[model samples]
Target: MTASLSQLSGRVWIYPGDPDPEAVMPCVAVVADDAGSTVVDAGQSPAHARLVQSALAEAGLPAARRLVYTHHHWDHTWGACAWEVEEIVGQESGATLLSAEARRSWSQEYLQEQVVANPRLGPSFKARARAMTGWADFAVRAPSRTFTDRLMLSGGIEVRHVGGKHAPDSTVVAVPGSGVLLLGDCFYPPPFHLREPGPAGEEIDLRQISALVAEGFDWYVDSHSPPWRPPVPE
Candidate 1:
């Protein structure tokens, strides 16, 4: 899959005036073979999923063999149902969190605040919210296999279920062969707004992510950015 999509230089695909201020979420799709591929972090809508699928097809790869959620955040995981995949994988913590009724309440409140604050989103936001109301009912499945520290996949693809930084169940995928690291929301670019205030009132761990970034890779793919070459510090 990487071989086919290797020509795709990762870039930020901006969706204007989306409900969430964190509207420009990043999604990564990797084609493993003719039979399958893996899509990392399905985006906010089915349309987004279709767009991803089309891109992969255009590159002569399957839509996805499996759908892997970087975390349980709505923006990142909402479009999983749209993809044709054999299995859906997420951090164990994400599965637990998604199953709890508390997640629905929290998500609803969060979306409400985002929509109200950004009236520019208009009817499309409300429609999306209404559609997402069923997310609580959506099957939030854990990885068929769980990992604590790090797990390596068939093709030297290493996924580390590092403990929470941005969201409690965040996982980072490292393709050692290609030197590509998909950090999900753990490493947000500038103007970050996903840092919600927690119970103890601490902001999300940007430093933890910075430390993660320091480990280094030739290509750094955020759930939000197109494949990017990490910058060298002065």
Candidate 2:
């Protein structure tokens, strides 16, 4: 799937994720600043990352000086190496997961074995893996710095650890100046679609979300969806 850069108002731009079978690239956010661009998430592979870089270059946005992961999910963190940034930030838990995942093989046979072992993760896993034509240069790099609760970057962007049922390490990036919140799959349920009478899934915690919304953000960016304006409470 080809990703094109679209401005989400002000200093934010997004490469919306593709839902097609060819590539399930996760949406990547670029927050432009005079210093440098702060990327919310890296895409699935080096190729995907290059696509993002090309899009940014064409848009005349600042080069990505920092890469921040919303979580350690393969779709979000696998492009770390390609970003070539000195600072990669993630939650401590997510950093640990990425460190461990960095040691694993992305081979087709290995991925197939994983799918066979975990039926709940089969469909989407297979689809994402199949989308990739090659993995010769694929590498997973853990964050250079890990934060426990919150971290404030050079720009007005804030990253918070908002764990959800989807992933314990899930986090969201808030650009207060732009009123845009980049949600990294923190509102999704676990693998329940592939199973009948699936195991009870945990509820998505909404307290943090509500509080963040209360903080004056009007636009929300989900990993799989385009940016949207959620009605702000009066």
Candidate 3:
């Protein structure tokens, strides 16, 4: 499933976003146009990034030249190290946060300490982290480009920093020609829970979903769930 690629609309292809029940990682999207190929988000680990790369190769598209992040969360930003993308982009705040996280060295000793220090984590969770040595040492490649508001790419992809239901640095990636909108963990099923545990994240405004119909997206994608069709307004 991780190696599959499905067409969303026109030249935009999607790597359906689904993660383990308790996991928050990249369910990525690819926009392949004449300008080149761009991966919307890098996944959670080098392994996750490999899956994306494999999918792209299978599709016969150019190597993903540009990668953009939806937010600063490790799940979406950590995988950039695995790709030889020429440009990495994100909102300024998210870029800064991700840079700090990338800069933090994660040693076996460090992971063990992090688990022990956190009162919220259980033994199994710590054990899981300890077992996954691949996640310990990797590049936390920060965005080469940062935008405060909205930025349009030369390839006709529009990235808008619409602060709503999720991280403060959250932005919407729109492939206008395809009428495809990628919602990065902004609004998901149940639509009531945070992308992460605890109260740190913001809740998406349910009322605004109806407005998405007005915006006219042929398809909608989520970070932790499958892509869905917007409800048709009567």
Candidate 1 per-residue lDDT, tens place, 70-184, comes to 7777667666667767877777777777567233443456567767898644443554565453445444334555556676665466777765546767788776656667777
Off by over 4 Å in 2: 192-208, 232-234
Which run of 10 residues does model 1 get worst, by summed lDDT? 9-18
Off by over 4 Å in 1: 1-24, 101-144, 188-206
Query: What is each predicted model's overall lDDT from 0 to 1?
Result: 0.59, 0.82, 0.74
lDDT of 2 by residue, 1-234 (tens): 666899987899998888763466789999998788999888887778899999999999999999999988878887777887869999999888888888888778888888888877777678657756678877789999899999998888899998877778999998878879898888877534433353445554567566666666768888887777878459
- Output the lDDT of residue 155, model 1: 49
Per-candidate TM equals: 0.68, 0.89, 0.84
Q: Higher TM-score: candidate 1 or 3?
A: 3
Candidate 2, run of 10 with poorest lDDT: 191-200
> Against the true structure, candidate 2 has what lDDT?
0.82
Native-to-model Cα distance after best TM-score fit, residue 150 in candidate 1, in Å: 2.0
Which rank order by lDDT, best down to worst?
2, 3, 1
Better of 2 and 3 by lDDT: 2
Better of 1 and 2 by TM-score: 2
